[model samples]
Every structure is written in structure tokens, then in C-alpha cells.
Target: MKVLVMKPQELHKLELLLPQDKIAKVIKKLGRQISEDYEDKDPILIGVLKGCVVFMADLVRSISVPIEMEFISASSYANGRTPEEKVDMSGGPEISIKGRHVLIVEGVVDSGRTVQTIIGQLRQKEPASIEIVTLLDKSKCRLVDIDIKYRGFDVGDDFVIGYGLDEAQKYRNLPFIGKVANE
Candidate 1:
């Protein structure tokens, strides 16, 4: 399948939600908390690909603890704005997670289904523990119960983009988080 690339002006108007400086401050705090909690225990951070790229990169840098990084592909939004009935989950961490602490890093947690699915898959690997860390949490849109150990911010039901979040696989390069105004 071919992808359509449009000029920036053609995209929907965006309203700034989280500025870069603020996001950075919050991430630093989260990193400190995680570092303290997982002290001495080396943890593996598994990032959900496509969306989590930017956030995960920044978050990992802020973390003071020694952590192994990995990437996995898990998405409920294949193309459209609303989530599809079935979440597409693939890819696995190359490193062994057996008897090790695992932290799943996510850019956004909306329906909670994708995270749940990932946790279930990782459980099979016999990890000693598993936790979640998300940059944005859309708790109101959750269809299933999920515990987010670390959360940067909570947002309403606005279609958000930028800072690794995208619409039609676009706007991931935007430095700050924004809501599509006309969406």
C-alpha cells in the first residue's frame, strides 16, 4: 500500500496542549521516581513502536538507572482515528525477560486493550514483574481496567497528535503535544 504525504498547511489546525519544557520537567520527575523504585534491579523497558518512539527516547535519557531498551509493535489504530475492533500486535523483545522486571513504555494509553494484550504476551516470557509507563493517559476512553505506574499527564477525549503521536502517520515530528481543533 502506498502512503499519502500532504503538505503541513493541509493538516488540521492544532491547539497546543503540553509544551516542550513542561513535558521535559515531568519526564525528569518520572525518571527519578522509576530510578528510585527499581534501584539495584536492572529493568527492561519495552516501548510500543510507531507512537512511543519520541517519548521513549526522551524518557530513557532522563532515567538515571541502568535499563535495557527494546521495541515492540502494538497498535489499535491501524489507520483511522477511532480504534479498530482488533488490535494489531507483533514483534518481541530480542533480550530475555525471564525473571526480570519489565516496564512497558507508551506514548498514549486510550482503550487500554493494547497494553493489556502486550502484558499478557510478556507474561508468557516469565518476567518477574511488569509495569506500565505512559506519557499521556486518556482514562475516560479506557474500555478495560489498566494500572499505569507512571503517567506524565491525563487528558480528555481530544484527538491528539505530535511528539510521536500521529494522524495518518503524520505530525510525529512536532515538538509539543497538540489537539486537532477541527477534528
Candidate 2:
């Protein structure tokens, strides 16, 4: 089968979904809220890798309270838009999560499979508390229930890219979030 590759410039045709300023505002609000909620707990900000890097970086900076940060890599989109039943995870938290307040940060939540799986695994580690914060929430596509403590935007079910989210590992460097054309 021939692989179809999208040129970087072709992304210009995508519709702008979330601008940088808007994303920043959301992150700032989330950061402040997290800081206030965890003022005494000293939470560990765990980023879901590959996609959460950009959002996590900005969010951590916006947060005023001191906190620890770590990354866990996982993916369920090996084939297409719909996530696979299984999640492939690696490089989980290095420190002990037992009794620690863990916060999972994600770029977007669509099917909720990947994040849900991660949360279940983290629960096994016996953290004091676990919560989720996502930059974008696509509730229309959710196949499972997830409690998102903080959400930046509620978007329709569309293939989005930018600000850390990607398409075939491309378009992640875009400064703003946008929906793929015809998807």
C-alpha cells in the first residue's frame, strides 16, 4: 500500500480551532486553579508524552506553586482516528506515587481510552489522589466516561493538530490548534 503524506504547507488550509492567546488563557486559568487546589499537597504533574509536552511546558510555567513534573509515554492511535483497545505505555513515573498527589496532563481527550488506561495503571501504584487536566475535550467522541478536572476547550469531533497535538507525528509545531480539512 502506498502511504499518503501531507506536506507541511498543506496545513494552511485547516480551520483555526484555538488561537495561541486563547490556549494561553486557558492554561493560565488551569494553572492557577491547580495551584490553589494543591497549595499544601505539592502535586506531581505527570504529562502524557508526545502530545502533552507543549501544553505541559506552558502550564507548569503558568503555575505559581512549586510542583514536580514527570512524563509517561503511551499511544492507542497506531492505525487510525479511532483508538485501539490496548494502550502501549513506557517511561512511567520514576518516583514512587504511593501517597503522592498525581495530576495527569493531556493535550486532548477524544475516545478517553488512552487516558483512562493510564489512570487505571497509576491507580495501581497507589497514589494519594489522581486527577486529569486536558487542553481540549471532545466529549462527542468519548467511548468511555472520564472525569476531567480542568478543560481548556470543548471542541467538536474533528481531527485536530498543533500546540503539541499531531497528525502522523507532523503539524505538532504549529503555534495554534486547527482542524484538519475534510475531517
Considering every candidate listed, which one attains the maximal lDDT? 1
lDDT of 2 by residue, 17-126 (tens): 78899999989999999999999898999999899999999999988888999999988888366677788899899999999999999999988999999999999999
**Reference-based TM-score of each model:** 0.94, 0.92
Sliding window of 10 residues with minimal summed lDDT for model 1: 1-10
Root-mean-square deviation of Cα positions for candidate 2 versus the true structure, in angstroms: 4.3
- Give the clashing pairs for model 1: none
Assess candidate 2 and give its lDDT.
0.88
Instruction: Provide the clashing-pair count of each candidate structure.
Output: 0, 0
lDDT of 1: 0.90
Query: Following a full C-alpha superposition, what root-mean-square deviation does model 1 have from the true structure?
Result: 4.4
Candidate 2 matches the true fold with a TM-score of: 0.92
As a TM-score, model 1 comes out at 0.94
